[model samples]
Target: MDTSRARRGSDFARLSRRVAEAGLLERRPGYYAIRIGLVGALFAGSWAVFAAVGDSWWQLPVAVLLAVAFAQVTLLAHDLAHGQICRSRRTARTAGLLVGNLAVGLSYGWWMDKHTRHHANPNHEEHDPDVAPDILLWSRGQAETARGLPRLIGRHQAWLFFPLLTLEGVNLKVSSFRALRRPSLKNRAAEALLLVGHVVAYLGALFAVLPPAKALAVLVVHQACYGVYLGCTFAPNHKGMPVLTAQDELDFLRRQVLTSRNVSGGRLLDVALGGLNHQIEHHLFPGMPSVNLRRAKPIVRDYCRSLGVDYVECGLLASWGQALRHLHDVGQPLRAARRA
Candidate 1:
């Protein structure tokens, strides 16, 4: 047993006990049952209506609605991936594969690996894949070395954020297929098959029902909206929170709290964001059911205050503003160099 690991997670362990005592960590079977049924019904219902509406421009609006359904199903898959609703690892993996790959055309294995790293190190520049300076620079160090398209885009990334998100849906699918090349991916063959199956079924339906041109247009709209809606759901989580480096040594509790921020909103925003507005709690307790995060917020906040740690939470728009400001500021150096 690694005593060092135990020591590092001690604070988190105590906090976990408190949360457990409050029953926050317990799975909400009733909540998840209804939630899953409703999302599944909505997903099936949307597709049925799309088929019923057949061969018309009116289907464009239906495409948008289906995008919402897609995002929601993806969110549910996220919950399953975290074992939020599943008790056994086997069950979680099976469910994740079905929900993510078969239904949504996303690779469960690929997303699981990426998301695990993120939860393990939320804003760490080196360890967290989420902050790894892909197209947009997350830190000045990355920005300095960025070139070509990334450099061009990083300079105005804040303004381009939403527009860029329109491409993320395509990017995600492409990335999933690409991840299959890696030997580290588990059950790669199954993941690949399910994803390909999703493509065949999805495209087949589009072309079968509508004219070729209209089919292409509807496909574009669905994917674009899916990307935008998915991006919008996640953008506010930790974009402006503190970025950590190797030197910033901290225990699990502080690590999770300091690097995360919460968005305060009404029930509508809460559901839309899929309980991600309570990102702080979600990070600290990854397996905690989404519905319980809100209830755990105050408890965690007061605990943080006692420990002299800052708990960040703000209104929805403010959170986005802070994130955009960070993106703009990171690009300031490049803009300055451009001017000179």
Candidate 2:
């Protein structure tokens, strides 16, 4: 039952040799320039919705819908920071920080640092530092063993995944503040100022322009929409990939592609994910503009075949199930020694 497909090729070896000669894929500034105009349009449109909601009969529905789109824009900010949507590092970080803090209420510096780590060591147990304290492993003879409440939560992540994703704003605030506090006094002062400034600015706008209750309602709606948008877009990738040991670059690249399957055939999914659904190609060339991902798919598939690595590409429904299965798998126990 397992031997009929064409034998896999040494696509990986060819890819590696090509990479050695051509270097890692880079982002093109043209992608960033065009997207900058698009982001501006999105930002303006969201603001128009915000303004119109205050006066129109369609207030509630429009607010809810636009809130969802605003959250998607937050993801755009993230991609920008990674230089995925943009080519210039300075432009990426500047745009990410501005939009992240203002539109999504997250600390840009903190998120960049943490997310950078996640990209460097996705699914790693020790080196990645992104895994929650309780993720389980099924290596060696301990494949079927269960752990504790952490195990339970990992196994049944669907219930908890929503809450965690929704509270991302709060999580970012707390974690970023904590990280800020750990640095020098000067840095701590700057962080405090930024925190206070963020709050004052938003609260001032709410109180000055809208009724207190209405302002609170708007904030609640905005955050909820943002959370839903985040989880749906991100969980599809790397949730089911192999957990890491040491931080080896090649191994990390392999896990990213092999574990992160793509969701196909939907324009909405591609737009919503900011084109991240082309996960394999994206992993291979993180800095490349996402518009090219679809075009690069066959190139990536060919490369993977030559390398004898599995390129897991699937449709949305199957990808979602795979993500759930990953959650279930995470409920087991770790085989590696705990880091001291």
Candidate 3:
């Protein structure tokens, strides 16, 4: 390890000790109960509205509400994957299957495999799938060597970012299906079955209740809102933060903290993002409950400051601006290459 890595390891050890001493690692069952309760209520309410709307124009607004509810439930699924809610690994996997595969049509097995790697090596170009090369160029190296459609998209990615987010729901569903085809996924059969059931129940109900045109419109609205809401919540977490390469030797604390950007806001923002506004703390302690992240934030921030590590936290709007600026900056070289 490098000198910085060594220092970070030492700092993390101290921080861990302080956190333990302060009892910050203890589970809060009541908080989680309240959160799960509210999420369940929202999902129920949204579905009830959808069922009541039938073929009326009110279906569009109901679809939007349902999309928001789905996004919120997804956050709970994220927590399940981290074992924050269900401490038992077996129980957590069960919860993940129910929430991710059954409820949201995402494969829990695939998500666990990808998310575990991300937690272990966040922002790493070679290891973290979140930052892996795609149609959008998020790094200078990726932009400089882009070709064909990717090159064209990279040139105008900043402008296209939000528009493209509208398709993220479809992208995620496709990714889940693709993941099921991989031989390495252990629970492939179960996951595939649950996803099929979810599709049948979800679309079957829509088509059964409404005309084909109305059903299509509701699908579009729901997916668009779901994608955009999820994208908005995730974009600020790491988009403008530091990117790690395969060669970096940073310790766990440094790796996660340096690559994560926290959004600053009060309880409203906290609830909106499912406590992900405390990105740095969440990354560092992935198993910690979402409700506890706020309390841990000041402790983690102060510890990092004392160690001279950069801990980025900014207002929500500023964080979004930073992400857009970074995307624009990365696209500049691609645009110049196209011009040439």
* Maximum-TM-score candidate: 3
> Is 1 or 3 the stronger prediction by TM-score?
3
lDDT of each: 0.91, 0.62, 0.88
lDDT string for model 3 (254-301, tens) is 898999999999999998899999999999888888888999998999
Score candidate 1 by TM-score against the native: 0.96
Candidate 3 lDDT score relative to the true structure: 0.88
Query: Number of backbone collisions per candidate, in order?
Result: 0, 8, 0
Task: Compute each candidate's TM-score over C-alphas.
Answer: 0.96, 0.76, 0.96
Give the runs in model 2 whose Cα sits over 4 Å from its true position. Answer: 1-13, 16-27, 55-59, 84-88, 134-155, 184-196, 246-253, 332-340
For 1-340, candidate 2 gives per-residue lDDT tens digits of: 3242222223345564555354345555676567666766776786676675563344455556655666666767667766776556776666665676655556677777777777766666665555645333322222345456544554455456666676665556667667666553233454455666766876675556567777777666656666666667766766666665554434444766765677786667777688888877777666656776777777778777766777887777677787667665454333222221
- What value does the lDDT take at residue 185 in candidate 3? 92
* Clash pairs detected, candidate 2: 9-306, 10-306, 10-307, 11-306, 11-307, 12-306, 12-307, 124-244
lDDT string, candidate 1, 1-340, tens digits: 9897676568677778899999998899999999999999999999999999999999899999999999999999999999999799999998998999988889999999999999999999999998988799888877898898889999999999989988888898999999999999999998999999999999999999999999989988999999999887788888988989999988889899998989998878878988999999999988999999999998899988987789998898898899999999999889988999
Candidate 3 local Cα displacement, residue 24, angstroms: 1.7
Q: How close is each model in CA RMSD to the real structure? A: 2.4, 6.7, 1.6
> Which is better, 1 or 3, measured by lDDT?
1
Best by lDDT: 1
